[model samples]
Target: MPILTPEERIGQVLAGRYRLESVLGQGGMGFVMGGKHELTGRSVAVKLLLPSYGAEAEIIGRFFQEAKAAASLNHPNVVDVLDMQIDDGEAFLVLELLDGQPLTDLLEERGKLPPEELFPILMPVMDALAAAHEHGIVHRDLKPDNIFISKDLRGRVTPKVLDFGIAKLTEGDSSVETRTGGLLGTPHYMSPEQAQGHKNVGPSTDIWSMGVLIYECLTGDRAFQADSVPALLLQICTFDPIPLADRAPELHPAITQVVHKALARELPDRYASMEDFGGALFAACREAGVVLPATLEELFPQHRPTIAPGELSAPPPPASEPEPEPVPAPLAKKPASKIVPMLSAVAVLLLVGIGAGLYLATRPTPTPPPVAIAANTPEPTPEAAPETPPEPPPETPPEPAPPQDVTHRVISEPAGAEVVLDREVIGEAPLAVTRPGDVASLEITLRLRGHVEQTISVTEESPEEVVVTLPRRRSGHRVDPVGAPALAPR
Candidate 1:
C-alpha cells in the first residue's frame, strides 16, 4: 500500500466512525488528528501510530499501552481515552478533544509564570498524578509537552495529563519497561535513579519529574541542563541543581522547600508518594500567598467509605422525661423558751418547793486566809532593733549588640563545585552562605573533581562574591617514562 501524506490523510475515516478533520499535533511516534464521530456528531482527537513504527512490536505495544493505561484512569485532569482501533495496519486511539494548547506552548509564550498562575495549572496535574499513583500507574515520561491546559465548557481552566505511552503499571506481570537505547526517560526530568537506568522505579520517579516541571514553570529554565544527553544524565545522577530559591528569588522559601524535597537526590529524601507531594505543593502555594483556583477538596477528592444498609441511619430521637410532682412546702416550727407555760404549772410548783427547802438548809460559809506576795524581778530591757541591710541595686544587663549582616556569595570558575566553610561542607558553589555576622572572617574552601583545592578568607569588607579559579590537578610520576611529557597545572 502506498503511504498517504498528512494532508491527503485528512478527511479519511477510521473504524468507519471517526473522520479525520485536520492534523492537530505530531510526535516522534504518532500523529494526533482532529476528528469527529460520524454517527454521534461529537468531536474527538485520534492518535495514530506512525506507519513506520507500526510494524515494530515495541512501538505497537507502547501505542496500545497508552490507550490501555489512559482508559483505565477516570479523572477530570487525565485525558479520556474513548475508543481504540486498528485500520489498514495503522493503530489509532480516539480521545476527548481539548480546546487549548499544550503547557510547552504556554511556557514558550510566557517566559516564567507566577505562583498564582502556575499553581492553578499544576495542582490539578498533581491531583491527576496522585490518582494515577493510587491506581499503580507511573507516568514515566512527564514534562511540559505532555501537559495540556484547556478551557472547559464553563470556561474554567483545566489542566490534563497526556501521552501515557510510556506509563508503567506496577501490578502483576503486565509491567512494560520502555528503556530504549539505554535511556528510559527524559534526562532533565528523570530522578537520579531513573537517570542511572535503574530497573525498578515507582511513584517517587514521577514526583521528581513533577518537581522539575514546577521548577521549570517558575524559573523558565530547566532544573538540570547540559549540552549533550550524556552530560545531562551525569548531572542528574551525581550533581545537584541550583536551589530553586536562587533561580527564582522572589519565590517564597516554603515553595523552594517543597520543590527541593521533591527533587532530593536520594529516594528516601524525596516525597514518598504523589499525595504527599500534592499536599506539600498546595500548602506551600497557600503559605506563599498564592490563591489556587480550586480548593483542596476539589484537587484531592476524599474517597467516601462504603456504607452498609444499617450504617447510615439517623440517630434515634432523645427520650422524653416524665413531668415531676410539685414539691410540698414545709410547716413553720414553734419558738422554744427556757420556762414552760401554764401546761406544766403543777410540776413548777413542785420544783419551787424543793428550791425553798435547799435555800433554808444552806447556812453562811467561813472565809479563807490570804498569803504573802513576792517582790521585785528586774524588768527586761527592750531588745535592740536589728539593722536591715540595703539590697544591692539591681544590675542592668549590658545591651546586646546588633548582629552583623555577614552574607557571603561563593562562586567558582566551574560552577556546582563543592563549598566548605569552617571545615564543614556547605552547599554547592554559586550559592550564598549566611554566617553569624559577629565573625571576623569566614574561611571558605572550594573543591571540584580534577581541580586543585582553593581556600579564601571572606571578611566583612570583601566583595559581594568570593570568586575562585581553581587550577587543574597535575599527576606526579615517580620515574620519567618514555613519551611522557612534563606535567603542569592548567
Candidate 2:
C-alpha cells in the first residue's frame, strides 16, 4: 500500500457515514480531519491511520483497542469515540468534533500559571483520568498535548481529555501490543517505570506523569530536567527533585508537598488514584488561596454544530404547549349563631344527666365488724413479736473526691511560633494555658526547617512549660539522633 496524497486521503469513509473534510492534525500513525456525516449531516472529527500503520498487526490492534476502550467510557470530560473502521487499507476513527486548543498550546503561550488558574483546568483532566481508571483504563501518555480545552461562546473553558492511544486496560484478558523493550510514551511526561520500558505500567504511572505536568504548570519548568532523554529518564528513576520552595518561592509549602509526593520516585508514595491526586491538588490550591474556575466544561465543548451545507433556516417550535384550566369560586357559608346555640343546648342536657348518674354510682352500703376468734389470734401474735429488737441501719459509703483541674501554659523558644495540638494545627504560638481534662491528651508538635521535631505532653498534676530550640542541619551532613522525640507532660 502506498501513501495517499493529501486530497485523496480526504475522501475516506468513516463508519460508512462520515466524509473526511480537511486534515486537522498529522501524527506518526494517523491524521485527524474535520468530517461530516452524509446522511444525518452531523459534523465530527475523523482520525485515519496511514496505510503503513494499518499494515502492522500490532498497531492496528492497538488502534481498535483504543476505540473499544474509549467507546466504553461515556463521560463529559472524555472525548467520545463514535465509530472505527478500516477503509481502503486505512484505519479510521470517527470522534466528536471538539472546539478547543490543546493544553500544550496554552502552556506554550503562557509560560507558567498560578494555582488559581492551573487547578481548575487540571481538575477536569484528573476527572477524566479517574473515570478511565474506574473503567480499568490507565492513560499511560498524559502529556499536556493530549488535554484539549474548548471555550464556549461565553468564554467558559471546558477541559476534555483526548488520545487514549497508549492507555492500558486492566480488565481485558487481551495482551498489550508492545513488548518490554519498546518505548511507547513521550519521555518528559513518562513515569520512571514507563521510561524503563516496563510492560506492566499501571495507574501509578499515570499519576507520575500528572505530577510532572502539574510541576511544569506551576513552575514553568519540568521537575526532571536533563540534557538528553536518557539523562531525563535517569533523573526520573533516581534523582530527588528540588523542593518547589527552593526553585519557586512564590508557591506555598502545602502546594509543594502535594507535588513532591506525586513526583515521588517510588510508586507507593504517590497518590493512590486520580481522584486522590485531584483532591490533593485542590487542597494545595486552597492552601495557596487560589480560586478555581466555575465549571470545567466551560473550557471545552463540541465545536462543530450540526447543520446542512445549504439548509440554513430556523428550527421548528416545540410540539407540546398546554393551557392552564380555570379555578372554581368559593361557596357561601351557613349562619354560625344558629348552629352554635343548638349545639350548646344539647351539651347542657348531656352534662346534667352525667352528674346525676355519678351521684347514684358513689352511694355505697355499710360493712360488718370481724369475729371475736380472729381478734384473739391477732393478740397472741403481738405478744410473740415483742421479744425481737429492731436491726441497726446500714452504713453509707464515702463519696469520691472531685478531680482537680490543673492549668499550664506552653512556651516555645521562639515566642510566637505556630503549634500543632493533637494532630489539629492550632494558630501561631504564645498559646494561653491549657487545663488538663479538657482533652484526652495534649501533644504539641513544633515544625521548623532544619530542626529536630519537638513534642511535649501535658497532664493535670504534671503541667509544665516547654522551651523548644530548633537545631540547624549543616549542608550535605546527616545527623543520627539519640532517640525519637519523647512526649513529656509539663
lDDT of each: 0.72, 0.67
Highest TM-score scorer? 1
Residue 11 CA error for candidate 1 (Å)? 2.3
Alpha-carbon deviation at 225 in model 1, angstroms: 1.0
- Which residue pairs in candidate 1 collide? none
lDDT of 2 by residue, 1-490 (tens): 5567656768866546667888888654557889887777777888776665568766777777766776666555677677676665666677788888998888889988888777877877777777677777788878888889977557766788887744453112222233334334567887887766667778888888888898888888878888876788788788887778887899888888988898887888888887787777666665676665433222222211233211222333344855668866553454577878999999999999999999888988558787566544543444445556778899898897765565555555434556777687776555665655534345667665433456655544333544444322212222221121311211
- Model 1: lDDT of residue 122: 83
| Position 235, candidate 2: lDDT | 84
The deviation in Å at residue 342 for candidate 2 is 63
| lDDT score, candidate 2 | 0.67
Evaluate model 1: give its lDDT: 0.72
Per-model TM-score on C-alpha atoms: 0.59, 0.56
Error of 1 at 32 (Å): 1.0
Q: Lowest-scoring 10 consecutive residues by lDDT in candidate 2?
A: 481-490
For every candidate, C-alpha RMSD to the true structure in Å: 27.7, 29.8
